[model samples]
Target chain A: MEIPVKTPSHSYAVTIGKGILREALTAQHDLFTKADKIIVLTDENVWTAQQSYFEANFPYIFEVHVMPAGEKCKSFENYNEVQTYLLKQKCTRKSLIIAFGGGAVGDLAGFVAATYMRGIPFIQMPTTILAHDSAVGGKTAINHELGKNMIGAFYQPEAVIFDITFLHSLSEKEVRSGMAEVIKHALISDAQWVEELLEGDHVTELPEDLLANYLAHGIQVKATIVEQDETEQSVRKYLNLGHTYGHAIEAAAGYGRVAHGEAVMIGLIFSLLLSEKFGKVNHQFTKRFLHFAMENGYPFEAVREFTFEQLTEYLLKDKKADYGQLQFVLLETIGQPFVQKVELEQCREIDRQLRALLAEV
Target chain B: MEIPVKTPSHSYAVTIGKGILREALTAQHDLFTKADKIIVLTDENVWTAQQSYFEANFPYIFEVHVMPAGEKCKSFENYNEVQTYLLKQKCTRKSLIIAFGGGAVGDLAGFVAATYMRGIPFIQMPTTILAHDSAVGGKTAINHELGKNMIGAFYQPEAVIFDITFLHSLSEKEVRSGMAEVIKHALISDAQWVEELLEGDHVTELPEDLLANYLAHGIQVKATIVEQDETEQSVRKYLNLGHTYGHAIEAAAGYGRVAHGEAVMIGLIFSLLLSEKFGKVNHQFTKRFLHFAMENGYPFEAVREFTFEQLTEYLLKDKKADYGQLQFVLLETIGQPFVQKVELEQCREIDRQLRALLAEV
Candidate 1:
């Protein structure tokens, strides 16, 4: 299935399906033909697991730079290393970059392409279910010591080629992590989709076709929001439904520990709790969502590990934070998000409530 | 004087004149009022020389980050440091950045603002004459170990405040370097302007009002071309008339060793030599241009310091090189520019001619 994304800066498409890597890549012949060199930037884990399949199906000669896996791949050091590699390879503005891993790899590679010679073309070949959300949007970044994704750009890819075949090698934890974004997508765009997910099989055990449908649906929600507001000036804030608090938790855990989607899952509940006060959202729905998240095993225990004080530092560092007030995307109801400015004291109250709910559950 | 630059991505004005900094910055009250924090990113040299003038004129409280002077300010390490500093200052998307230095500081600061939290508003408060070209174009970058401006983005500034009063602190070499671009603007836009410049006083001894006129004229030439092609995909390539060969010489000599415009002066002559062979340019005109360059004290001796073989690596590394073929913006006539793909052998022939002309002169 092909989903078209149109932003003010550029327009491209996301092709998602089973075993579509070779065909999807082959369709982008024009992009490849113009490139003086094609560079594949991936992580050690992804490269080791899918190297042969990628090489067999890519249908082009390219150089590969394998970085350390997970959030480490999005470090300042690794970002610099990848740039040096491109320079050594004599990559120019006409050279193309292929981001051939999950979110971390895509983020790092996309940013590298965005800034290398003041922007080069890059394609996103995301290999994880989580990337269904990340790959479509132009939000590319590397983490700073002070915050997760503290440095980045809203540079879109020329195309996104997501072949579910690559997901076969992913661990169960990765599936659970990826599904959080899918759930968040459903929450922000379709109440019926959220209901279906709540009534469905274990997120990790979903049928292959069903998972692909969810991924496509998530990309569509993100694409629509991005089209309206590419720079997060307004409507795009809805896409950060769970990320503000989620990033704080993720950053507090030193990144790669809680997993991005897992922390976002935790943040979904936090937003729901805030919604209960700021919007028409009910406590019952928030509790029900929390129950569903716990059933999927989203490491709520990580929240207990860090005190509200520890998370406060990271929370205020959020890109969404305006002045000292935390700006959160809260739901008026399922499928409707609104931005709200919440005080630190109110956030602490919500933090306390989350812990108490966790203890009771 | 106000000149408007409208690129497809953004639109802003360059406010140029003597002592215009105070009034120009104050006029941007809306931009300043909206910013949660205002940061002035400058180099040690600029801040040391003009801090009092800047502070007294600029009617706002802002945090200042003073970096290493000159090209050293564009290093990857310094780029990282500037980002870190912004993060430490807790600068959010609402923050405004002031790039208050020459081309190097503006380049570094603009890239930081471009990528910080995925871009924020920045104003170019350029201090040196060299910045008349760099500040208005929205081309922000930091130097990579492998190449100058190998990593950056084409992010436009909120406004450019070119205060000619700042030029009083510049050295004679700096003035000569800055005038090379003015001459280039004239070469690429108007033949009569070039003739007048050829007949004018020594570049360093030009009257103050005339220098300002030349800088404004240079900016208008740049603004018009940039408005046509913001990212250098088409007509904008003409703006790089002397930069292909100029960058090679500058990079070979090491940045800061030979001032940018001085090397561009050398590149201008090289382009003229190439023009004599490939276009309607006359050999006598090329020689007269070379004589004007030597009389004005451009460092042609630097070209003889590096052999064509020594400069070949940097030449191939030029961002304009497509699949190893050097793409140069050559002049068809005094005011008409076109791109040509020249082979290494032909380039060597022109290098020999340039050396012979310098020796004869």
Candidate 2:
């Protein structure tokens, strides 16, 4: 499946399918032909699991820079190290960077490409289901000591080549984590898509073809939203649907303690509650969504780990926070998402409602 | 005088005049009005020299961050400190950054603004004549250990406020350094402009109004080129007329030993010689230009400090370089420029010619 993404700055395609890595990469012969060198930036976990597969499929000669697995690779020190390596390698502006891991690797590599020699072309070769949404968006960043992805750029890639064959190695927890974003895409775009997902098999047990379809659908919704607002000036804020609260919990959990998508899944419930007050969303749907989440085991139990005040510390630090007020993406009904400014006092009330509801269930 | 810069990414004006800092800053009332907070990033030298004047004329409240003077402010450590400071101050994407210094400060602050929160609005308040070139172009960067400007972004500013009042504090060497780029702007765009500058008073002693006119003219030339090619893909390479050889020498001489514009002046002489060989430019004109540079005390003596072999390492690292061939921007004639690939053997021959010419003179 080839989904084209057109933004104000540039346009590229997200080519996604099972076992499509070699063919998809070959399709971008023009980008590779111009590259003076190709550097693959991946992580330890991905390299350990799929190095042979990647080596066999990727047709071009490239240098590989294996970084620490997970969020550790997104640190300032790691970012600088990668830059120093590029400088040492004499990577020119035409040197292409292959972001060949999950969201963390893509963010770090994309940002590396964005700033190296003031900017260079890079291709996103996402290896995880979670990257379906992130790989298509031009948002690339590294974590600051103060916040996650506080330092980055809206640097688009030359292309995103997704080979779902890599998904075979993802643990069950990783699948559950990745599916939260897929569910997010459904909630924000189509009511029918949301119903289908809600009634589907457990996230980890999804049939292979159905999983690919869901991932493609998610990328299309993200691409459409990104095309309309590449820099998040307006409708792009809708994509932040659960990230504001999600990032807060993820941050409050001390980063890596809770996976990103799991926190976002919990934040999704919080938005549904707020949507009930601000939009046409009803409590019944919100409850049904919560029950589905409980069945799939999204780790909402992490919510009980920190108080609202602890989470509030991270919330106010959100990029979307305006002079301390919270900005949230909430649903009007099942699909339509909108930005709404919510007060801290009201947020606390929602926290109470979420805990009570979680306790009852 | 207002010179507007229109790049594909953004459009803003360069407001240049004597003692016009306050008025120029105020003219962009919409920018300030939208900013939640204003943080001025300047070096100690600029803040100490112009703080009272800046404070008195400035129409708004702002936090000032005085960094160590010169290129030190553009280090990775300083970049991190600035991000931490902004985070501690509770700044958001709505906050504005004011880059108030020479090229180093502008590069650092512009890059800080470019990466902070994935980017924020920034205005250039350049305090030196050299900035007349750096301020208009949105090529923001910081120095990496291995190379100058290896880490950066092509982030355009909201506006540029050029107050000639700040130039009064510049040293004679600084003025000489700044005029090299002004001379370059003339060399690459208009033959008449080059003749005007060559026949004018010594760089440090030019009449105030005339200097301002020259600076404005230089900015206009830059704006025209940037409007055509914002990212230096084609016509913008013309602006790099003296930079390739200049940067190598600047690097070989250990950066601060040779001022940027002075090195560029020497590089301009080198290009003229290359132009005589490759283009229609006459040797007599090259000699005349070399005479003008020597008379202005542009430090042609610095050329004999390093051998061609010593500078070769940095030359190959040039961002415009492809594979291993050196890419140079040479004039077809004064005011007409094009890029050419020069082999190492040819480069060595030119280096010998430049040395022998510098020796005989």
Candidate 3:
């Protein structure tokens, strides 16, 4: 199936299916045919696991550059290496880049394409379920020593080609991490989807068709938010529903140690904990969500490892933080997200409450 | 005087006047008051020359990051240092960056602003005559190891404040280097302006008022083209009239050793040499322009240092070079610029002619 995204700066589509890499790319032949070259930027893990499959199915002739896996691929050093590689390969404005891994590779490759020759055409061939969210949105970045996604651009891709056959190789931890974003989409956009998920089988055990459906739904939710606010000047803040506290946890854990979506899942509960007092969300629902998260083995142990004060340092560095005020995306109820300026004092209070709740669970 | 630049991504103004840095910034009080912090990215030379004047005129408290002078400021190591500085200074998305120097400083700072937190607002405070052209359009970049501007983004600035008072402190070489771009602006836009420049006193010796007028005219020409083609997808390529060969020589000379616009002046002569054969441009006119350049001391000596063979490697690496075909911006006549795909053999012919003519002069 195909989902179209229309932003002020770009208009592209997300083509998602099982074993559709060759067909999807062939469909977008015009984007490839115009390019003087095509470069596939992947990571060691993804390339090692899926190179043969990719090579067999990728219709076009292209060169490939393998990077260190996970958040390491998003570092400033890696970002520079990719550009140097492109320069060495003589990639030009006409060159089309294929971001051929999960979120890390997508972020790094998207950013490289955005800046290479002041911008070039690129497509997202996302290999992980986590990338269902990232690859669709044009938020490309490299990490600064001080923060994640700190140095980057809102450069959209020409298309996002998600061939789910690649996801067959994901580890259990990867599946749990990827599902957090899928769950995040459900939580922010549809209460019915959230309910279905809460009562469903293990997140990693979702049937193939159901997994694709959920991924498609999550992408649609993200695409709608992104279309409304391409640069996150306004409505797009809602998409960060679980990210405020989530990113702090992720950053404090030093990235990769706590997977991005895993930390986001923890943050989802943190937002819910805050939502209880600030919005119409019930303590009962927050508790049930916590129960759901625990049963799914979302690592809440990482939270105990860092004190709120330590996490607070990273929290203040958030891109969404206006001045010193922490801006969070909190649910009025499931499916309705709003931005709120929470003081450091209230955040500390919620952090304390979250720990107490996690201890009981 | 104000020239409005209206590009699809942005709309800003070029405020050009003598000694108006204080007033120009004051007029944009809204932009200032909104920024949580202000960062001034400049070079040692510029800060030393005009720090007192800037501090006296600037209305706000700003942290200054004085970098190594010239192209050194745009190196990858320095780009990383500036980001670390901003992170240390706790600069958030609300922070505003002041690109307060010539083209190099503006390019570096503009790029920093472009990527920091996925972009922050920035203003160009040009401290030299050449910046009247560079400061206007939002072409921000850093130099890669392989090529100049191989790494960058097309990020627009909020406004470009050209305080020509800063030019009073420039050295003779800086003056000559800067006038080349102003001359280029005239060449691509107005035949009358070109004739006026040809008949005028030595470029660096023009009356202060006349210099300001010429800069303003150059900015207008640039602004118009940028409004139409901000990304160099169309008419904007005309602005790169001499940059193909100019960048080759600039890169061949290893940056800082040769002033950018000086190399451009040499490339301008090369382009005119090409136009004589390919367009209606007369050989006599090219000679007259060369004579004008000599009287103004444009340093054609830089060109003699690198042969066509030596420069060919860099020329092939030109951002505009596609699949070994050189894309040169040539004039059909004065004020009428068009893009042409010239082969290497023809480029060699032009190189020979340029050398023979330079030897005569």
Candidate 4:
């Protein structure tokens, strides 16, 4: 599968397929043959699993920087370590960094490569299913003590490799985490896919073709918004459908405890409830959303525990806030999202409804 | 006076004047007027000197982050501190940062601004004569333990305010240190100005009109080269005319002992001698270079102390070097510079010639 990511400098391709990891490596070497050096940045976990495969296949003099696996390691300290490695190894302006793991590795390595020499060529070899969203967007960043992705850049990668063969190693929980982004993609744009996802047996695993189709649909939906507004000047904010609340949940309760996708799953349901109260979507739509999300084993009581004031504080500090007013990706209906500057009172009302929804849960 | 820096995006103006310091306060307000808040990153020296001015003159609310003053302060710890401050202040993407002071403050603050929230608008208000080189270029970075300017980005400023008023209180040594860069500009591109500078008294006071002409000439020469190759692809390497050898002298001597410009002066003389030894220039040309450099009172014996091997190591690790090859910027003739890769043997021969020439001191 091929998807286009729109950015200011150039557009890029996101290629998704099973057992395509080694093939993508070959293709990249062919494309950037003129490059002087090739660097691959992956975590210890990915390196343990696949370093030998890459070393055996790559034609270039490949070097690997093994970062500690997880969100906690995405600090300036790691960024410094990667920079030191590049300098010591004599990586130059002509060098290219291959981000060859999940979102954490991609974000850390991408940011290090982005600012290393004021931007260099980087390719995303996303190994996890969740990265279907992270890999496509040019949003590369690292966490700060203050917030998630507090420091980052909108640096686009040259290409993205979505090899499903790597997905075989993903635990059940990882797959579910990835599904949160997929659901968010459908809610923001594709109504048909949402119907398909909801109709499936929540207990059973998705067939290969069905999963690929969902990933492709999600990519296309995101690609459309990004194509029109690459820098989040307008319509692209729709893609933040559940991130406003999702990021808060992840931040407040220490990251990695609840995977980003898990928090987003809950955030998606909360948005649906808000949508119903705002009269953009009816009770039928809300029921469908809750059924799909609950069947996936998303934690709803966590949302119930969140106080209105807590959410308000997080929203105020959000990047999307305009003149201190929180901007939200409110659903107009299923497969629709719009940006709105919601007042504190309006947000409180939404919070009140969320508490009621939690009582039912 | 205003000079234009042409980037692919848009050509922005750089202003140089007295009392322009006040104008710099609100100059970027239009671009950042809708900002949620404003943050100022400065050093103890600048904060003490100008914090009150900012409070009295600017209509908008602002906060200040004071860092230590010097080249050594551009560290990862400082970057972390700035991020923490911004986070604690609840600075969102809408906040703007103003880097007020000399090169260290600008470089450190610029890197912080470049990576914070991915990136935000930042303005440069340079207060030293040395900043003529640092301020104009979009190169914002921090020094690492292993190398100088090892981590960085090519992020341009929203605007640059070169207030000459600050120079009025500059010490004689500081004025002479800054003249080194001015002399470098003259040596590389303005031969006629070199003759004029040689005829004048040492720049004891840096009178406004004379300093203005010298600054304007240097800015024009630099801006022209930068315009042609904003990212140092080709023509911009000419600006490194003296830096190749100069940085080695500064590093080996222990930083801060020999000011940057003073070291650059020695490097300039060495480059001229190398040009002559390689048969690129006549003895008369080299003699004229020595005459003006010596008359300018820049230290000479510093280059004599370091061996070719030490200098070679610095050049190899220089940010300008592509891969392991040392990119030496040699004068094609006075008023022209060209970059060529030099190996250890070639650099050794050049160092030998430079050592012999320093016998006059």
Candidate 5:
């Protein structure tokens, strides 16, 4: 399956299939023939798992910078290291960057490409399930010591290779972690995907062949919203449905305590309760959504531990805030979310309600 | 005088007049109102000089970050510090960064604004003669540990505030340093300015008003080129006339030993020699150009010290190189400079002739 994202500078094709890595990379060579130098940014694990395959298949004498795996490496230090390496390598504007791993590698490599010589072309070869969400959106950045993705740009890639063969090596936990974003797509826009997740085991235990189906479906939903409002101006804020509370949870817990997807799972549950309070969605819709999210390995303790005050502070610091107000993405039903302009007072009320709910739990 | 640089995003007015600082800032309240927060990125010197004046003139509260003043501060460490300050101040997507100093402050702050939140709007409040060149161009970046401006982006400003009152505080050396760029503008494009320079007194200082007139003219020339090709796709490469050898001189002599303008002056002399060798321009044209440049306080030692091989290596590493070939900006006449695609052997021949010329001097 081919998914293309159209932007002002260029158009990108997201090729979804098994063993498309070699072909997808070959396609990139065709697009950037003038560029002979390639920089492949991938984690140690990914390099260990598949570096040789890429080295053999790639039609150029490229350098692969094997970064330490884990989200912690997505720091300013790492970004500087990559910049130093590129500078030392004598990489020019015509050189290309290949983000040949999961979301972390993608974000790190993509940002390096974005700021290197103003901007350069990079391709996304997403390996993990979590990358389905990350690989599609043009949001590329490294995390600051203070916050996650505090420094980044909405720079799109030249192409995205969603190779399911890479997903075959992912652990069960990694697969579950990636499903959080996929579930997020279903909750925000894909009503049919929600039904499919509830009926089938797509979200629970994603099969390799079903990987393309789920990845394409998730990307399509996110891309459609991103296409209409690329800069998160209006409708695109709906994609932050789980992220508002989820990011707070991730930050407060000191990142890597809970996976991004797990925190998002809890965020979705909290958002559901807020939806019910706002009369946007009923109890039945909330129950069904929570059931699907929880059964797919989301922890209940996530919501119980973090106080509402902590979450509120995190949301307040969110880049999405407009004029000091906390912006909320609430659902009208199970599958339709909208951005709500809520004042500080109303946000405090939501925080109070969340704490009360946690006390009851 | 109002100089406008019309870009795809917005039309910025670069005002050049006496005591325009307070008026220029106060007039921009509408733009500030759209921002979630406002930060004035100024050096310690600028803060001491004009921060109080700005605070008194502006109605709303705006944070002023006093950075260490100098070319040394244009590094990733300072860039991070600015990011930290912006984050701590609760800056959001709507935040506006006001760079209120010279070229270093403008480049560092503008780059910070560009990279922060993908990009935020920034206004340029230039306080030096050198900034006439830096202010109009959208190029914003910080120096990497390894190289000058190794990391950055092509981010334009919301407006440019060029208050001539600021020039009253500038030293004679600073004034002469900036005059080199104006001379470059004339050498590259304007025939009339070349005639004016030739007619002017050798070793004679420019009157305050005439300096402003020269800067305004220089800015207009650069602004037109930038407007045609913002990313230096073609015509904007003309602006790099002296920069090819200038960068080499700066790097070899250990930056700050020679002023940027002084180095550019030497580069200009070498360029003329190269032009004469390439049959691009006559000896009379070269001599006249050289005379006017020397009259303006351009240093001769920059060209005297380095071997041709050293300069060639630096040129090879230049951002303007295409497919291993160094592009030299050679003069056609007194006011006509064109980019010449020169190979390494051509570089050797020019260097041999330049050495002979320098020996005679």
Candidate 6:
């Protein structure tokens, strides 16, 4: 199935299916033909697991650069190395880049494509369920020693071709991480979807068809929000419902340890607790959501590893933090998100409440 | 005097006048008031010369980062260092950047602002005559080891404040290098302007008022082209009239050895020679332009420093080179520019002709 994403700068489609890599790429014949060279940027893990399948199915001749797996791929040093590789390969503005791993690979490759020769065309061929949220959006970046995604651009891809066959190699932890974004998408847009998910089977054990449906739904929710605000100047902030606090935990854990979605799941609960005070959300709903997260094995213990003061440093460094005050997207109701400014003192109070609730649950 | 630059992605004005820094910056009160913090990115040479003037006129408190002088500021190392500086300074998305130098500083700072935290608002305060062209067009970049400006973005500044008083510190070579772009603007847009320049006094010795007038005229020419083709997809290629061969020589001379416009001046002669063969341009006009350049001292000797075979490597690496064919922007007549694809064999012939003509002159 093809979903269209329209933004002010450029518009493209996101095609999702199982075993559709060859067909989706072939459909983009004109885009490929226009490129003088084709480069595939993936990681060691993805390339090792899917190289044979990819080579057999991909129609065009291309060069592949397998980078370090996980957050290491998003480092500034690796970013420079990929650029050097492109330069060595003589890739130009007319060249095309294929981001063929999970979120890390997509983010790094997308940023490289965005800055190479001012800008160039790239397509996201996301290999993990987590990429359903990242690959569809135009937020391309690499991590800084000081922060994650501290440098980047909102450069859109020519197209996003998500081939779920590549997801067969993913570990359960990866699946769990990917599902948190899917859940976040549901919470922000559809209370009915949230209710279904609350009563659904283990997130890691979802049937193939149901999983694809969820991924597409998540992409759609993200696409609609991105269409309204490409640069996160307004409505796009709604999509960051769990990220402000989530990134703090992820950063404190030295990245790749707690996993992005696991940290986000923890952050989702924090936002829920905050929402109970700032919005129409109820305490019973927040506790029920925490129970759902706990049952799904999202590693809430990671939150206990860092003191609120430890997280506070990373929290204030958030890109969304305006003038040293924390900005968060809170749910007025399950399906309605709004931006609110919270002071450190109030955030500390919420932190205390979250810790107490975690002890009770 | 303000010349408005309107591109599809962004629109701003180039406010040009002597000692207008105070008024121009004050007029942008709203932009300043919105920024949580302000940063000034400059080079040692520029800061050393104009820090007092800038500090006196600037109405806001801003942290300044003084980098190495010249093309050193555009190095990959410097780019990374600047990013680290901003992160260390605790700059957020609402922070503003001031690019307060010539082409290199502006290009580096602009690209920094374009990519830092996805992007942030920036203002261009040009400190030299050469920046009259670079600062207005929204072309921001940094040099890669493989090529010049191989990494960058098409990000426009909030406004360009051209305070002509800053030009007082430029050396004779700087003025000559800057005038070449002015001549290029005239060659590609106004026949009368070209005639006036050819008959006028040496470029470095122009009266202050006339120099400012030429800079404004050059900016106007650039602004119009940028408005039509912001991303260099079409008419904007015309602005690269002399850059193909110019970049080759500039790269061969190791970037800073021969200034940008000095190399462009040599490229202009090469393009005119090519135009004589491919367009309505005459051989006499090419030599006449060469004589004017000789009288103004544009360093044609840099062309002889490297063989045609040596320059060929950089030529094929040109961003304008399509599928290995050299793309040249030639004049049908003065004030009329068009794109043409030339083979390596034809380029070698033109190189020979340029050598013979230089020897004769």
TM-score of B-chain for each predicted structure, in order:
0.99, 0.99, 0.98, 0.93, 0.94, 0.99
lDDT of 3 by residue, A310-329 (tens): 99888888889999789999
Clash pairs, candidate 3, are none
B1-361, model 3: which lDDT tens digit per residue?
A: 9989999999998899988888899999999999999999999999999999999999898889999997789899999999999999988889999999989999999999999989999999999888888888799999888777888999999999998888989888889889999999999988998999999999878899999999998999999999998898899999999999998888888876788889899899999999987888999999999999988888888878988899889888888877757999999999999899999989999999888998998
Question: Which runs of model 1 end up more than 4 angstroms from their true locations?
Answer: none
What lDDT tens digits, residue by residue, belong to model 5 across residues B1-361?
A: 8888876544687877777777877788789788767888999887777766666666666788889988766978889998998888888889888898888999999888878878888999888888888878888888886778778888889889888777666776677777788888988887777888778865237777787788889989988888788887788888888888888888888887887877788778778878887646777777776766666667775776877777766777788876566888877776676788887887777767766765664
Candidate 1 - CAPRI tier?
A: high
lDDT of 1 at B228: 92
Spell out the clash pairs found in candidate 4. A152-B118
Q: Candidate 6 lDDT, tens digit per residue, A1-361?
A: 8999999999999999998889999999999899899999999999999999999999998999999998899999999999999999988889999999899999999999999999999999999988999998799999888888999999999999998888999899999999999999999999999999999999999999999999999999999999999999999999999999999999999888998999999999999999999999999999899998888999999889989999999999999999888999999999999999999999999999999998988
True contacts kept of 1: 0.86
The global Cα lDDT (0 to 1) of model 1 is: 0.92
Tens digit of lDDT per residue, candidate 1, span B217-303? 999999999999999898888888888889889988988889999999999999999998889999999989988999999999999
Of models 5 and 6, which has the larger lDDT?
6
Each prediction's interface RMSD?
Answer: 0.7, 0.7, 0.8, 1.5, 1.4, 0.6
lDDT of each: 0.92, 0.92, 0.91, 0.78, 0.80, 0.94
Model 6 C-alpha lDDT per residue in residues B227-261, reported as the tens digit of each score: 99999999999999899999999998887899999
lDDT of 2 by residue, B213-298 (tens): 99999999999999999998999999998899999899899878899999899899989989988999998898889999889988
Q: Which candidate is the best by lDDT?
A: 6
Encode model 4's per-residue lDDT on A275-315: one tens digit a residue.
77664788777876777777778766676565777766676
Q: Which ten residues in a row have the lowest lDDT in candidate 2 chain A?
A: A251-260
- Candidate 2 CAPRI assessment class: high
For candidate 1, write residues A152-219 as lDDT tens digits.
99999999999999999989899999999999999999999999999999999999999999999999
Which whole-number lDDT from 0 to 100 does residue A103 have in model 5?
A: 89
The worst-scoring run of ten residues by lDDT in candidate 3 chain B lies at B316-325
